[model samples]
Structures are given as structure tokens and as C-alpha cells.
Target chain A: MKKENISDAVIRRLPRYYRHLNELCSRGVVRISSHSLGQEMSITASQIRQDFSCFGEFGQQGYGYNVEELKAEIGHILGVDNDHHLIMIGVGNLGHALLQNFPFSQCGFTVDAAFDVSPAVIGTAVNGVPICSMSELDTFIQSHSVDVVVLTIPQTVAQDTADHLISLGVKGFWNFTNIELSSQVPDVQFENIHFADSLLTLSYRIANR
Target chain B: MKKENISDAVIRRLPRYYRHLNELCSRGVVRISSHSLGQEMSITASQIRQDFSCFGEFGQQGYGYNVEELKAEIGHILGVDNDHHLIMIGVGNLGHALLQNFPFSQCGFTVDAAFDVSPAVIGTAVNGVPICSMSELDTFIQSHSVDVVVLTIPQTVAQDTADHLISLGVKGFWNFTNIELSSQVPDVQFENIHFADSLLTLSYRIANR
Candidate 1:
């Protein structure tokens, strides 16, 4: 597989495969063909082959891919090979829940600090991740050199917070603000997880069905 | 937009455009050309025009689109024109937070019921939405015919829960589980929200930058 130029869509699906492979490995499945894996994912075998080929050839024609090896490879490709340091912005209900659950460090990403506007929550800690005031974002980010930010701010302040983070040299944002931020910051990537959008998509599928 | 045969990718982007337009409206922007909206989204004006054209011609060549009108049209296209009924599975930390925050009814979706395995949580109410045992899911779903199901279950039970929902004729799912589910029922749509994937994409972008 090539080390450069992976499509965003393909990159998005790597975790899906990695997770499935992990499950299969746990279930004692040692090998899988692109066809079977694609069947499980509802994608075409050829498409799976092409996506995998872009990274590097890990499967043999007749023998297929080794489940454990494929899981490790996909994990590395998805950049979960190393532990990541993350900070959460807006430690509200959603942020608090995310902080308490989803032990990312155990899975290769760590939430080291949390930020909020409320003084009440500022000094508290969720899951041992210290909650700090938004005023400390720049210093905390600079000192910790945080690699990713989980944005759980309100829709109104989403864009401004994103801009501020970008200016502070933050390269990636996991935005849960429900705001559509369309800025081109040279090396930064933003993933929008809009609750409304998710529900709407579900409604469409249900109505259509 | 056409009411039929809309691609899933296009459907997904409608909410994005809707949110973007909402922001513009809040800022007191009256109208926007497709070119400018496209630039904001990192897409081309013609592509934006084409997407809007699928439903109906909402823009003029010289005048562009009315901000409010376009927002309304997108809302309709995404089927958020009216309120939708939503149910939650796994009423744990994430589920509790979702119920308390992001009240979807305001945006056209309402959380009517929640299901969990915990006896302590069952028969309780979170933000007016009643929590029931998993055993009651089928009856509740049949009675209400919930339009969407939000799955915040653990990874191990994710697929089983999805299967249960689909068996009871669930059409759409907002899956927050780390596990990726492929639909066996063609009408059932599953949106896998991987927190890790977002972090990985951010890490990749940051590293590359």
C-alpha cells in the first residue's frame, strides 16, 4: 500500500474494518478474503481490494488475509498505532459523558484536559481529566502540544472556537457543535457530528423504507 | 431533494447546508450566491446548484438563493419539515446526556423512549422520556413505531441490539457503538459514529501538517 494520498472516505472506513477484524480475531477467525469482509460490510469485494491495495497488499490470492496482521495493519493506517493526546472543549453534559466513558488512551488516544466557560465545572474533573477555563486553552494546548480537540460547544460559538483553536495551531477538531464550519485552514481537518443530521438521516431512511 | 432516488451522500450534505444557511441567517445575511456557499463548503458552485436543482430551482443566476427560503427547502428535503419520534437504546452515560442536552424536538425530532438493561435506570425518566427495560422494546416500538433508534450500547451488544431493532422493523439507527454494523435489511440504515475515526483523521492531518 502507498504511504501517501489516502482518500478521506477510505480512511474513514479503515476503523470499520479494523474493528470488524478485531471482532473476528476474538472469535477465533484466523483468515478472511476481501469478498467475505466486503459481504460483512455491504461493500463490493473489488472495492475492498482496491481500498486495501492503496495501503499495501496484505492478502494472498488463495490464502486471504491473516486476521491479526490485518487488524494491526489497519490500526496503524488509521493512525491509532500510537497514543494520541486530546483536549475537550465545552465540558457540558455531552462532554462530561464523553470524558467519563470512551477510554481513548487505552485504545490509543488520551484525553488529558477539558475546557469550559462555567466556573463551577472549571475546577472539577471527569474521569481524572482536569476541567479548566477556556481562558487557559492556548497555554494548555501549547504546553501539552495537544494533537486533537473534541469540540462539544454550542452551535453559536462553534465556529469562533474552531477559529481560535486553529489560530493556536490545533490541527484537528472532532466537532460535535452541530454547526457547519467551512474553513480552509491548511493542515487542519474537521469532522462534524451533528445530532440533528444523524436523526434526520434516520428519519429519511425510515420514511423511504 | 427529488423526493425519490436521492443519494445517501447528497442526503448527508443537506443537513450541513441547512446548518450553514442557518448561521448565515443568524448573522443577518439576506442572500448568498452558490459560488460563495460552495467556497465556504470547499465545493464548487455548480455542484451546489446541481444538488439544490434536484429538488427544485431555488436560486437565480444573478440573484442567488434567499437565505431563509433555501434553509426551509433543505429542512423539507431532509424530512425535518415536521417533528420525528426517536427512541434510545442503552440508557447509560451517553444516552442520559443525549436525553438531557440537544433536545431534538426543537429541531424536528423527539426522544420518546429509552431502553436499558439496568433495573435502576428502567422505569425512570430522563428529560421526560421514559426509560424501559430491553424486554419491552418490541412492544414499545410497535406501539409508537419510532422513526429512529439511537444506539449507545456497548461494543459487544451493538450488533445484537441492531439485529433486535431491525427484527422489529426499525428503519434507521444512529449507532454510537465502536462496532460497525452492516445492514441485513436493505431498508434499515445504520450510521456508525466512530469517535476513534474522528481522532485518527485529526491525528493524520496534524502529523501531515
Candidate 2:
């Protein structure tokens, strides 16, 4: 199926499917029926079938799905097989946290370098990746083929920074800036990190409960 | 409207509506048509109308929605009007980033205090909130009315920490532990923050493009 035809709801659920399948595979789960998979994920068995049907079939009538094979299939569809090159802009606390904590390489993204304007942080290194100055961003982008950029910059300069990166041939962005940069440039691919939205949803549950 | 009936899709969209309406209200855009709102958000106007309908009426036909009024309505529906007290566990890199950067007070959750195990960090102040020892968590929770707990702890100790807090009377959690804790406790509430999912989505976009 083409990307345009897939609903946002389906696209969003893709990662979860990939993650669940990965867990099952790691734990030596040979196979999983939609009903049991649904139980693990808290989704309905029919809904699980429907979500997977949007992509393609990986199961039979009563045979269920092979955990490793299904995971590999979903991984291919989600592009988890691609070794994406990433550069983090703004090496603040959040940047450091991501650099130190996130298993980017294991997940198929290699964070080659990080950039920042802070003099104290510019020369510093985290996880053996050199932190470059803001002035070197254009050079860095030119020298290395950067696929995705992680924006940890302040909101004031977020869009401008993104525009600069896009102009410099960056393909996509993993934005953490509080602003809505995705909407500004429709042609550019963006995955906005909106933490507050989750917090608000949690609040809604609390209030509703 | 009841919680169970409302689809997760619609509940997730409420934040976007709240955020967009907030921006519109801030920009002095008093009124907005569904069509314009849809265009701005990259959603269908009918979808926007349908999502809003899940809550309550905040607009009139042809007249459009009052941005400020609608924002306030959504804010209330999202429990943004309620003051939520938050206690952050593990004042590490991610924790510090959140405390220093995120606008918790502005978003209805006030981060009253933080906790850490390290001697170097304990008793330190981040954004005026004191970081106490992890041993004091029970006492702190007992003394204060903490509605939400921010778990920035390691995955190994995450569930145990959550269980400890729940026994201490905490109602909810905003989890970034990289492990699923919400499903373990069926009756409890949580919003898991997964940054890796966004990276995977970005990878998909890059590969597909």
C-alpha cells in the first residue's frame, strides 16, 4: 500500500507492532496468533488482523505467524533495516540523555555527531561522538551524508535551524523543539516529539477517572 | 462522554486541537473555520469536527469557532484547568533536562520536588525544586499531594519504583523508563514516552522517500 492511502492511525501503530514482535522474537516465542498477540498488546484480535492487512499478509487461517519472520517483515516495512545517519543539534541535557541512553545504533540509526553553540559543550564528547560548533553545521552536513537531524534547540530558532538543515540536504528531522515545525514545511518529513501532549492525555485520564 | 467509548485516536487528537487553538489564541486569531483549522493541522475538516464532537460543542455553523473560547473548552476537557502536583524520580540527565526545560507549571503539572540516589545530586536544586535522596521518597509522597510521578529511572528499577510510589498514594505516572509499566498494572494509569518510536518512523520516511 502507498503511504498516502494509509491512515495516520495505522502509520502510528506500525512502530508498536514492530516493537511487540521484536520482544516476542527475543524471548524465543516461535509463533503468535492474532488473539494472543492482541492479548499482549491490549488490542483486539480482529483489529490486529485489520492493521496488518493494511500492509500485507504474514499469517495463515489457523497457522498463526512465525515470530522472527513476522518481526523481520515488519522491520523491513518500518525501515528498521536501514542504517540511518543522524546528527543531533543542540547538545544540552536532553541531547546528552539521548546520546547516552538511547540505543540508536541497535535500532538502526547512527548518531554520527552533535552540534551546539555553547562553548563549554562544543568541544566536549559524549559516547565518542564529537560535539561540533554551530558554525560547523553546514560543513558537517556537507562532509557527511546526514539523513535525519535531532533538533534539541530552543523554539525561537527551531524553524530557522530546520530550514538551514533542509537547505543543506538533510532528508528528515526528529524534532524535540516545542514549536510545530512539521506544519511549516509540508514537503519536508518530520517526526515531532511532543511530550506535553502525552502529559495532557494523562491529565485527561486522571480527571475523567 | 465516557472514557471507554472514546477511541484512543480521538483522545490523542485533543492535545493537537488544544495546542493549535492555544497558538491561534496567542496570535490574536479570535475565530477560525473548520476548513482553515483542518488546513493548518493537515487533518480533514470533518475529522476535526468529529474529534471536537467527542467532547462538546464549541462552535456554530458558518460563524466558526472562537479560538480563545474553544481553547479554554479543550483545556478544561483535557484537565488543563486542574492543578496537578508532580514528583520526579531519578534526577539524572533526562530528569534534569525535563525539570530545566519543560514548562510543567504552564501545563497544569507543577513539579514540586525531585529525588535521586547519588550523594552529589541529592539536596541540589533544579529550577528551584529541591532534589532529595531516594530514601525520602515515601516521606515526601506522604507529606505532599503528588498526583503524577515522572519516572526517569533506569528500566531495571522502574517497575519496583512505580510499585513503591503507588503504595505511597501516587495516582498516575508520566513514564520515560523505556519499559512498559502501565500494562503490568491494569487499573493504574500511565503515559509511556518512547522517543525511539519516532526515530523508527523517521527511518521509515527516509527509506520510503
Candidate 3:
């Protein structure tokens, strides 16, 4: 299927669909109608069918969808089958939580190493990924095949560090830095995780209440 | 302004506008036009005008929007003017990270207290927010008015814990337990922070490359 034809909303929902289907598969549910799936996801069955149709036919008439096959197709669509390498920057509390709890390898990315400026955390390792000094970052990127750099560093240095990484041919960033990046470098693909925006959205809900 | 008439998309963008305006304010930019604001936000000038117009007439025609006034209006609309109390239920690494870094008070939600089951971590205070025992959860809710609960525990007990909280009249949850909750509970607002979804979204972008 030509990706350019697919709307970003459909592409974003692909993961949610994959997640729901995986849950069903784990529960020994073999087949599920779009109507049932719709009820579960709070989206219309027609919408679900339309979304899946964007990637070619995967559902059967009357029989509905096969859980394993549908999930596998979505896994492929989400690039979970293809291995992606991630290098983490800043071994602070947030970084440490992500490095420990997030099953990166299962979801297509493997964190190869981490880098930190603080002397206290520089020589340590979190779950086998060694933390190196900032001096080693440029050389490490040059030597290793790093696909994405996960930034959880301070906002003060976030822009400079991101620009430096992008210059080293790194094309993807999972940025958590509060700098609202893309202000400096505008080229690469980025999934800017703005946690504050999410919090404020919730705050708005309370205020409205 | 009647918030009921506004779309969720507009409300979500409100926080983003607040953030951008805050930056301009910090830089001493007093007034800005829709055209310049749109250019900075990568949104259409007409779209920005439309969004702000939903919350009544705040923009002055021909002159432009006052940066400080616009931001303060958005902040008030988001309920940042009202104080919100939150109880964090799991003092794990993620919890600790939020406690140490996230300025919840600035966003209108104050971290009243934290609770944990780990013997090693219990009886500790993170940034002066005392950590209490799980036994205190029910009693604490009965005594104090907590607007939300931050969950960072294992998925296995997430639903049970959430059910327990909701039964105790807790209406909001900042869940990070990896469980897509909402089982047997109703009428509560939730902002599920699926960090994995954000990561997988980035992975898909990388794989598509």
C-alpha cells in the first residue's frame, strides 16, 4: 500500500488497533467482528473497517478478522518487525525509569547505550546499557549504527545537543526535553513527547468540571 | 465563553498556545499578530484566530493580540487559575521523576502526598511530599479532597486499585500502569499516558524511513 495515500490519523490508530488485537489474541479470542472491536475501542465499526481498508483487505465477510494475522500485519505496519537502535542521553530519574521499565527491544528499538554529563552517573550502567560521558557521544555515534537519540536532558542544553546529534546523521529523536525543539533544527522525523501538554489537558478537564 | 461549544482539538491546542505565548512573554514580546503567531506555530493564521475567537473576543482587530493577556486568558480557560489537589499512588522511579521535576503547582495541580508499598521507599519524603502507606489511601481520601490520583504501579493490580479509588469518589487518574483501564468504572475523566504508544509511533516513523 502507498503510505502517502493514508491519513496520519489512520496511521496513528494502527498502534491502538494492534494493541487491542494483541490483548484479544492473548485471551484466546480467535475471531472478532468490527462491531465488537468498535464497542471495545469506542470507535465505530465502519471507521475500523475503513482504517484497515487503507492498507488493503485484512478482514473477511461474516467471519470477521483473525486476531493473530491482523496483529502481525499491524506489527509490520508499525515497523515492530524491523529492529531500531536507540541511544539515550541523560541518565536522570526520567531516563532511568524509561531505561528500566520500557521494553524497547520488544517494540522494535534496542537501547545500545546512554550518555550523561554528571560525574556521579557517568560510569554506571542501567540494565546492561553502559552510561558514558558527554565526551564519548560524538565518537560513539560515529562508531555505532544509532537510529534515534532519546533526549531526557535539561532544557538549557537540549537544543544544542539535538543540533549536534542531527549533524551526526541521526534522523530520529524521541525528545522529552522541554525546549519545544524543531525551533533550531527542522529536518528530521521527531516524536516530541510533551508530558506537560498532557498534564495541562487533564488540568483543563478539572477546571471545566 | 461556553466551553461546551468548543471542540476537544481546540482545547488541546490551547495549552500549546499558552506555551508559545509564554515563550514570547519571557522574551519581552508585548504584542503579536495572527500572521506572525501562525508562522511561529506552523498553523494557519485563520486557524489561530478561529481558536481564540471560540473563547470570546480577546483579540483586538488591526492592532493584534496582547501576549500577556492572551496567555493569561488561555491559562484561566484551562482552569490553571483554580487549585487542584493530587495524590500520587506509587512512588516508583516514574513517580519520583515526576515529583522531583514536574512543577505541578504551576499547572494548578499540587502534589499533596504520595503513597508506596515498598518497605525501603516508605516513610520517605520526596521534595517535602510525605510518602504514606497503602492503608492510608482510603482514610486519606475520606479526610481530604483529592482531585486526581497518579498511578505508576504494575498493570496486574491497576484495575483493582483504580476501581477502589473510583469507588471512593476519585474522578481523575493520571495512569501510567500500561493497563488500558476503565473496567467497571464510569463517569471519570482520565488522561492515560501510554509512553509506549509514543515510542512505537516514533518507531513506525523510523521503520517507514
Candidate 4:
């Protein structure tokens, strides 16, 4: 399967397809045509075929696609089977919430530990994930093969924290800090989540509508 | 301003521009050239100029852009001046975290109330925003100007909850449920936050690298 030359738009759509297929699998749906899947996802059938074709054909012309097989294939392409190790940088409100609720394991990642500056939460745990002091972060990352660092710290310290983590061999970042983190190091992936952006986008739609 | 023909890509960049301009304003930077701004944002100078052109001319030909003025103009275009009224549905971990930390007021939104089915939190408040029973939702929305609903509910009830909120006159949604909400009502806007998609994107990069 050719992964190179795939558009970012198609890569972004893979998770949506993975999610929708998960729902279909749970409901005992075995197979679906591009037209039926398109209707369910609100995407065009031809567009679905085109996207799937980017990763090699997962469907036959007449027999459609096997739901479970397609989901597993997409999951593999998304690296869900790799079991990436993750750590949270700030055990703040958002970080605490994510630790409590986010299905990280289901998405092929594990929270090895969390680090925070606050003394009150230093030894405590959220959803069984221990909150360690910031001083222990370097040692923890060195000992553990930490792949992604979840940044839920204040924007003022976000970049510095990320830089420090990157130096400790962290390869990816799931950033919740309002500020964007641009790593000077190559091969470091940053997925910055700007809640305000989503809010502003919604506001724009509401205002225009 | 010609808002009609503005592409979604440009709309998405408005918030980033707003954020960077804000950083500049806080630092007392008075003006910037499109080339410098583009460098800061990693976007091209011509692209920045073209995006701003979709709205209107907010810069001088040679003097560049007045930092505060351009930020304010972009803010206005993103409806940050509208003072949108917002409420949170499902006071779960994610919703609780948002209410406690999200800078809603900075983006021209006010959280009026939060709703949950749990009796333990029904009369409580997070960051002074009262948490009411879900039963009171209809009456509260009936009496107040609810512009948006923040959904952090379970995916199982996400669609029904959104439908009910839409029926009660909510025009916007900042949806955090794992499921996507497609409102049958016209003019309703949904900004679905899929954390898994972001995570998967990161994982893809890691695996491919």
C-alpha cells in the first residue's frame, strides 16, 4: 500500500472512517457498499472510493467492502496497533479530565504517567495514572519509551515544556495548550488542539447564518 | 467585506491570525508586514494578503498592518464582538474541565449555565457557572438567549441531546462527544471535537517516520 503522496485531507478523514466503521462493527454490520457508507458518513461515494484508493483498494466493485476488515486495515494504517506510550505534561483541569475520560487505550496509546508542577497533586493519581513531579519527568521519559507528550499546561510555559520533553526523546505531542508548538527538531509531530479556534469557527457560522 | 466567497481554509486560519496578533499586542508590537506575519504563521506572504483581502483591506500599502487594528478586525470577522451566550450540557469530566479553565470570555462568549442528570452536581457550580438539572434545560433555554450548547455528553445520547437542544432554539454546538452531531434543523452549526482523530494523526506520523 502506497502511503506516500496521500493528501493531508485524506489522512484527516481516516480516523472518521475508522470511527464510523467501529460503530458499524458494533451494530453487527458485516459489509457495506461505498454508496451506503457515504450516506452514513455524509461523504460522497466517489469521494470515499477515492480516499480508500489512496491507501490501496479495500473494496471490490460488486461485493463492496468487509466492515471489520476495512476498520482493521485503517487502524493499522493509523498505527493503532503500535501501542504508543504517552505521558501528560500538566495535570491541570483539562489534563485531569482527559485522564479520567479519554479512551486512549482504545486508540492504541497508553498513559505511562503524568507530570505536574503543583505540590498538591504531585503524588495523587487520576484514573490510576500517577501524577509525578516535574523533576521526575526526564528520568521517566528516559526509562520509558515515551512517544507522545500531552500538553495541558498554561500557554506561557507550553513551548518550553514541549522543548524540554522533546529533548528527552519524545517524538509526538497532543497539545491542548492554546499556543502552537513548532518543534525545531525534525520528525516530531505536533497535533495542537485550539478549542478557541473551534469556538470562533462556530461563532462565525452562527453570526453569518 | 465579501464573506460569501471566503474559503473554509481561510476561515480556519482567522483564529490563528487572531491568536498571533494577540500575542503581538500583549508584547506592545504595533504593526507587522505580511511577510513577517507569514513567517510567524508559516503561511506565505501572498496567502496572508489574499486571506485578509477576502474580508477587506486592513493594512496600508507600505506601512504594513497596525497590529491591534488588524487583530480587532479579524476578531470582528470571527464574531468575537457578538458576545455569544453559551451553556454546557453533560457536566462530565471534560465539561467540568472546560468550565474550570477555558477562557470563554476572552473569545466573547459567556457560560450561562451547565446541565447534568446527576443529582450530586445539579445545584453546584463550576467557576461560578451554575450546574442545573437537565430537566431545567427547556425552561432555562426558553427564558434565556442561548446561542450555543457545549456538549460533553456520552456518544450514545449525543445525537438525541443535540436534537433536543436544537428544538429548544440553540443555533451552535461545541461538541466534545466522540460522535458527530448532524442537526436536522437548518442554520445550526456543529463544531465537533474529535480527539481521536488528532491522536490518530499523530500516531500515523510516528509510525510512518
lDDT of each: 0.79, 0.86, 0.86, 0.88
- In candidate 1, stretches whose alpha carbon ends up further than 4 angstroms from where it belongs are A1-7, A52-66, A115-125, A128-139, A155-169, A181-186, B1-6, B28-33, B49-67, B115-139, B156-169, B181-186
Q: Write one digit per residue (lDDT tens) for candidate 1, span B86-117.
A: 88998877887788777587567878889999
Can you tell me the CAPRI class of model 2?
Answer: medium
TM-score of the candidate numbered 2?
0.95
Best by DockQ: 2
Candidate 2 clashes between residue pairs 3 or more apart in a chain or in different chains: none
Off by over 4 Å in 4: A5-7, A27-50, A62-65, A117-124, B5-7, B27-36, B44-50, B57-66, B118-122
- Evaluated on the second chain alone, the candidates' TM-scores are 0.91, 0.95, 0.93, 0.96
lDDT of 1 by residue, A62-85 (tens): 999999999988777666766777
Between 1 and 4, whose DockQ is larger? 4
Off by over 4 Å in 2: A1-4, A182-186, B1-4, B183-186
In model 1 chain A, where is the ten-residue run with the lowest total lDDT?
Answer: A200-209
DockQ, per-model, please? 0.46, 0.75, 0.63, 0.64
Local accuracy of candidate 3 as per-residue lDDT tens digits, B123-206: 889998999999888999999999989998888999999999988999988888878888455558788887777878887777
**What would the per-residue lDDT of candidate 3 be over residues A72-155, giving only the tens digit for each residue?**
988888888888889999999899899988889878898899999999989889988999999999999999999889999988
Between prediction 3 and prediction 4, the one with superior DockQ is 4
The fnat score for candidate 2 comes to 0.81
At residue A143, give the lDDT of candidate 3. 97
- Report how far residue A175 has shifted in candidate 1, in Å: 2.3
Query: Which scores greater on DockQ, model 1 or model 2?
Result: 2
Candidate 2 vs candidate 3, TM-score winner: 2
Q: Which candidate is the best by TM-score?
A: 2
